[model samples]
Target chain A: MVENYNDVKTINTFEIKERSYFSILWGRFKKNKMAVISLYFIIFLIVVAIVGPLVSPYHYTMMDYTALYQTPNAKHWMGTDDGGRDLATLIVYGLRNALIVGFGAGLVEVFIGILIGAIAGYLGGQVDNILMRFVDIMFALPSFLLNLVLVVVLGRSLFTILLAIGLTSWAGMARLVRGQVLTVKQLEYIEAAKALGASNLTIILRYVIPNSVGPIAVALSFNIPGAMMMESGLSLIGLGVMPPMPSWGGLISQGSRWMLSYPHMILFPAGAFALTILAFTFFGDGLRDAFDPKTE
Target chain B: MAQNILQVENVKKYFKVGKKDLKAVDGVSFALEKHKSLGIVGESGSGKSTLARLILGLIPPTEGDVYLLGKSIFKASKNEVKQLRREIQMVFQNPYLSLFPHMTIGSNIEEPLRLHNIGTKKTRKSIVLNLMEQVGVPPQYYNSFPHELSGGQQQRVAIARALALEPQLIVFDEPVSSLDVSIQAQILNLLLELKRKTDLSYIFIAHDLAVVEYVSDLIAVMYLGVFVEFASTEELLNEPLHPYTQTLLKSVPVIGGEIRDITISGEIPSPINPPSGCPFHPRCPYKKEICEIEKPILKEVKPEHNVACHLY
Candidate 1:
């Protein structure tokens, strides 16, 4: 038995590289093939959104009346829309705006969520009651209608759309973060931190926030896609990015009338929108499993 | 003579659960001299943990006060209470849970020092390295996260963190219970060696009589949130007076001696609605009619030996 144990120990003594918490998470994330592929796709889309329009053969507003409602051809790879604008250029610019709205609103949602959630969760009692009641009211409201009203009132623009979606959508994220903070704050480590004389703020920022990062990240991933889809929906109704500014939703809405005549127009923009949203969902699902503390 | 390192003047902690109040620690009192170890032995729900929390000021007592170095913690100002933390530390039962999961072992050990703003960055690093060395943790584990290390190693890191500020009193709440039997002995021996080399005092809480016997200069046996008997280690082990204490001793299997029959049965009653009169009366084999009607206060039956029983 002793010899066998020694042999097993020797076999197990091969060099294993040291890993930090993030590295461990990355290792788990890498194990999911679909998530990894989705992550790469999202990165590619972001890169395309940034650089695609800058290198497009024609400007988004440069119309070609001769090619109006044209099908896919050498001159216009994805064909021309009703305005005869290059479908490729329109799609690129639309993607850029959509990406901005998705990520920008995502930032807004995460910030507000963490701030309200941490405060409410850490300072329970009357404060919790007031804040959570407010959250409950927000949850009761029709989020899409609220977004629509804000956009119509504020006027259509990238900034307005991002704010409308972000401000209205943060209630769910706040509730998620609040639940995470509640559980994390009750752990013995938090009590240990308190016994070590760490202040309430330090405990919240260091212990509560770091422990809740997994759930928050997962929530943010889903929020990005949710925000993007919401933006598309708004744009489809003609209140999103406005004219002269191409967005996936605006392109899809314009191409719908000419769908039978030129299917490529709606197909290109809608396909990009659907695929990006799917990528984010897959990535979010992957993150949920990867960041789960109990997985190991 | 110098003052005792710690004094608990009838500290009590009652938690409101729904409509009823659970008296977790009902007016428990004790004092410890410098460099002495007081072992508080009790099974689950005996308020041993609550007593530790009260002493540490992690939770406010419902009544009474805890004094550290002649200052009442409950009566002290906010800053004063915060300052008191530097003089007292705690090692939790589960080393894995007690440690900050995101931090490396070195940073975990250095946390208390950093929190108190003690020493420069360079000095703190050196102090952490020295502590790790003293605790028998390897130098290579400095960059390792808490989960990377084994249970024994994580516990050593915990001890290092507790010792960073050189506290006068350290509370060990079932610190060795989470480890395996072999690791338990190793950690207990390390604690004993640490006590021998330093002027540190301890309030060691554990459910195991044998483990407590190895480290404690004094012993207090708790049941249902109150101490039933208190005596020196040798005195309590050799001549336990309270029926509950004897029942606990008999439950432990002796190495060479014949195992005494267990007289106690059934689980401990809930603190919310404990039995009338003596809390141990229902489980006490030598119970009398008087034991059911009147509560027994801990009183001395011998020099420095106390028992709370109607027979006494």
Candidate 2:
């Protein structure tokens, strides 16, 4: 038996190199048509937000007395707001501001969540109990109320709003990451890592965190839209981005006052806001589907 | 004579389940010589896997000491324990779960070398490739993820990873149980070849008596977290003195031989609240009055043959 084993020739076939993580993700991501369309729409929205103001004849802060509440015409596209500021310029710049807050606050939330969740999950025992209990307490308070309190105390600014939304939103993410870590830690590879003499930090950063990225990525996509909605909610109550800065939420708030006479003002900004949120939701769902290992 | 590589002295691991203590490993004692394999045979929950974990230092023993090359592991400092990991490695039962699914096979094998800071990046790659060759894993599968490989292939990768550090002792915890019968023979042969090539000592844990006999020099038959018989492989196979060991041997299907009746009865007792006297007395066919009233200690019946039974 040993002789026969030794006599067998080694197969030396060479194949193409393995696909990278991004390429594989892109391959799966392209299969869903709605997700692909949503991605393109988001990208287009971002481009318009960035470059649209620069190309327009009117600036967001520019007010013309003659064009007040003008309907859509060739001279001033998408009409003019009550302030006579170009609605197109305000909407585009408003989108830019919303995107900034969404990404900034979303990243902050994910970072804090991952840090707390990874530590809680990897350490386990007393440390896990303490941290998870803290997360549970945080979850008990309505996030909007928490954000409201923070905005009121800190005095509404872009940074304070970002901080409030980020601080309030991470409890859900931390919980998700903690559950994922708990499951991943029980796999035999973790024991194998421990047996191989890997330190706790190295194992957490290299093995545990990397494996938990799929769920984290999905959570992150969902968080962007969530942050944007929170910022909008705060804005509706006069605590959002201060006027003249032109946020989507501020525009909607301004438009609501004139709702009886001209419904176009509310319709324009609300439509934009709804479209942006829908795009994010669709994109996040696609990511969740793409990253689902069971689908593979 | 070869020096002793491992000495497990009266190791006990008890877990607190609610109000009662589960005696997972109850006062097990044994020593393994350098370059020899000691097979521990037992049913599931017999504490065979628990004993392996204790030796690996994955879980701390409730009592007793494990000495590797004359250095006490339980008493070692943090740094000493870290260094001890290099001397011992393990191959877990489920190959699919044992390897990281995200990493390629080559990177998975290279993980330990990186963890220990053993070699440069170039040297680590070369070492991984060499290990892949040694384990008969095709070079082409090196870049593939674990899920891409068959169960047998994944096990070969796991073994190669265990061999990467050149540890003196490798604990095989039913390493072939998840593979097909034909693949089991292949993996067994591979293990035998690796043993011959590296002069590595092994603590092979399995419930299959035949598989254990094929690889082990010394055999230990465990019942309810304690050894019922300890002897040389040949002696235990030829003449098992303990009734538990005899019933276990008869249960192994032998082709073209007179089939003996399977005499063992009763389910294994729960370790949380085991019987007061001998653990096997409830199932032993030759249980006497003494067997039910008092526990039996392992007593030597012949040279290198110890049986823990009243009959002995």
Candidate 3:
């Protein structure tokens, strides 16, 4: 690329390429082989989360007295825990909860973060000072501990877990969005907007926000897995969704009780969490490459 | 005579530096007739660009007023200020950083139209295409990023973006000063062509006298924070009244002229703590007791020409 631009200064840009934004983004995204592979892995995780439980042979909740603490077999692929619940079935049922909390927290946090940070960055006065101070305060606290306290206060449920993670998780995105807006608001297009009779709000939302989507996209993709892992960590530690509702964390917590005897119970759920986080992180890396053409 | 399109009435801008107020623009005033270009020439710290910023309302004044179409820009309400913005725009020096890197060339051009709500989306598309055409950008390049274009093309797009609103006055603040010599000539020619086709007015600011003379209808020589001389380009070049303006012309590299470019001896003073009376006194070889003690007012030396110096 350096070699390509070396003459560099004198290129006839008159008949430049017909590269649309989306096409360029898509083209760059396709170039990252690792990210594409991770994206497929994430899609597979999504598929399992929504449909895995229905196809499980044994019921996730129903206890079979005859096959208590049973080892791996044709009926129960991942073997049974001390309660005789199908380990494979439990992993299957846990997917729905994992995806919901991950996606919900990710979406809500990014939305609030982008809105607040964009406003704060573009306004850049008393509002930026106050809001960013609050963000700094929240940022200093341990997110996991915050979730633990929230679950205790709100009564540990899947919904509360989602809300807690969503509320505390926006700090990263807010900072990212604010940084992006700080750089983007100074752009000539923004001044052009002001010079064209555009109101402050119009300048902010139309010019500032849309132009700032790249960083927000990167921040969103990066934070989703962190939210999911947080939810699972909370559940694993008994501060997350209660025993009856299946979660990767709940399964891991249940499996840890009999870790010596039934290792398969804990291993599968923990493995799922690890892989999902890795996939999302890789996807985020790919997206950054795709969205930012300056890398080209 | 052309109706006055812009009248800058003793504009002063003071910013805090260290502890004292650093006067960026100190009582600078000039009037530009309609469709006429004013070339503001000065050294780096002479406040030429700041005066252009003052005229464009990029920053507000501390102790004076700027009138556009004969109305106070400072006292105007938000709606009034915004409406005034539609008629004037500015282009910056660094073409590389001027454009939003993420947006397509077309959308960047269309941005001003969207801001004014001038027409529907379809109308904006056509306007952008026409503007791009006028600026010598092909239809294919509309969707490209700023990085893809050469420095000259980017400035052309910046030109296209400036022309988006059909503004009457476009301020070029060292617009070509950042580019190479070849690209600089290209951008200068483009601005001249634009003025010819659109009948637009310009406030051209530069550190060099030669470039300013080429594109200017009038030239205002700025020293420290004031215009030392303001006259038609031909008159100012032929008979620069202010000693500092003459020093500037003397400094210009000449091919066959008898006056050596090695004439001017001293540098411009820092604007923060300028000279005691006249900002040009220390640099003026003909400095006297009165020149060191008394600041001169801009006096009309010839018809439609003014100079601020003790001799004048």
Candidate 4:
């Protein structure tokens, strides 16, 4: 509508600043107050996880034998556990461990999901049928049981647990990404890209994936919490990180034994885990709403 | 003989729908000369869009070949096909859906240049600016996304992107049908101006006979999956030989052309199980016993004029 020919000539000297995709995504993402709060909460959790242990006077392994199962006080916050380890320190370190597994396993799951989904969606027909069938087969197995089995076989460690969670959880993400890719690939712009002589890889990376990023981002947000929950569940069953490492799930399991006598032990770690998952879910939901073009 | 920029030799494209093969484009052949425009007018299910895809090499034909600058596009290797793409481009109908929604107008237009590894960044930018100007897109809109612009503006950007490669032949699949009448005229004028400035051949596909007549040098009337009539624009409009072409011309709401009741009965038959013999026989008012038994091939009835009707 700005149709002045003379003004057009002046535009050559006018440098246009490019607005990157992430900036636009951020602009949309910030609109949801709940999502924004959730994002801040996630950032806070990450910071505490990374820097909390470094600054804490009490280490997760260090135990005070004189004050066993002491309630919250200045000397010991969130009380001491059955082992007389500071529950506050254990909670912080436990949160950090949960987050590591959440993010690490979540990223791996997303990577696998995107690869399989992109392939299935872009190359429909026989390739789609085969890959999607594999996804169906994966869906048939009880994912939690499979993760437990994997942890048991591989000898439970952070690496094996992360791998187990990532391997089992990707099928759902792959299915979600595949559905998004199918729709995006059919858009007229994709055909236009093909006509422009864009290679399959170029079309997928540049157009299809970027267009479908909204749903994928939403899926990623949800996957982190899902992975964290999986890790917690495994740890609760005594198949998670060993006793030396303080995991949120392991702490909750230990606290459950003293549920009647010491409620604070179960309360602190369980609350943190629940709050973290809740924040992620809210953020993921908000992202889904924000990225949904139909919502606008 | 003037150089033929593109030649389609009996190109046939069939899709299997259930147990039957849907003949989307069957034995269609035509040659487009340099700088000449060929308008393909057809109804919704006439395979005009499919024909455009075949020419663009987005989909390969079941039989025959498309020759671009004397090279068979179907038989071309991956590298050869990539090279062939630089010579041919396309403008889709829905401008809203054609341009990449995520990219800025400048980036969308510069995409082909980047894809083909054409000019340096500075050169590509300048080229994009020039194309934007040529397509009547203002410079301020260069950094704007597709959704920010109106339907007409988005189409102009699509045109600019198509022209970025300086392709010899550009297939326009009802480029202006999705815009307002006022906007359609503006875009049509821009296309005409471009055609004059650059000797670019166009395969313009549209269901609107009037719009097709305005821009086409040669007009082909397609019904079902075949060309019912093919001739120069003026001759086809003035003296339409095929019954289908006459009906199409009559259907065009003229300002004050002797108001007479002209109607054709029946619907376009499904391509999957097309009517026996002539595909249009079911809809043809002048259908005879032979028309239902034998299919008529396109034959020259006049110099540079061809028709595929038993009556011919």
- Model 4 chain B weakest lDDT span, ten residues long: B254-263
Report the error of model 3 at residue A110, Å: 2.3
Minimum summed lDDT over a 10-residue window in model 2 chain A is located at A7-16
Give a tens-digit lDDT track for model 2, residues A29-84.
77778889999999999999888978988988899998899888898778888889
Model 4 ranges with Cα > 4 A deviation: A1-18
Off by over 4 Å in 2: A1-14, A53-57, A73-75, A259-263
CA displacement after TM-score superposition, residue B222 of candidate 2 (Å): 1.1
DockQ comparisons of all candidates to the true complex: 0.51, 0.60, 0.46, 0.60
TM for every model, in the order presented, reads 0.94, 0.94, 0.92, 0.95
Q: For candidate 3, lDDT tens digit of each residue in B23-120? A: 88999877888789989988998887778778878778998998998888878998888788878888888766877666788988887777667899
Is model 2 an incorrect, acceptable, medium or high docking prediction?
medium
**Over the stretch B121-238, how does candidate 2's per-residue lDDT look in tens digits?**
9999999999999999988887888887999999999999999999999999999999999999999999899898988999899999999999999999999999999999999999
lDDT of model number 2: 0.90
Instruction: Give one digit per residue, the lDDT tens place, for model 1 in A42-157.
Output: 99998988888778889988998888888888988888888888998888888889889999999999998888888899998999899999999999999999999999899888
Model 3: clashing residue pairs? none
True contacts kept of each: 0.66, 0.68, 0.56, 0.78
* Model 4 RMSD, rounded to 1 decimal: 3.1
Q: Provide i-RMS per model in Å.
A: 2.6, 1.7, 3.1, 2.2
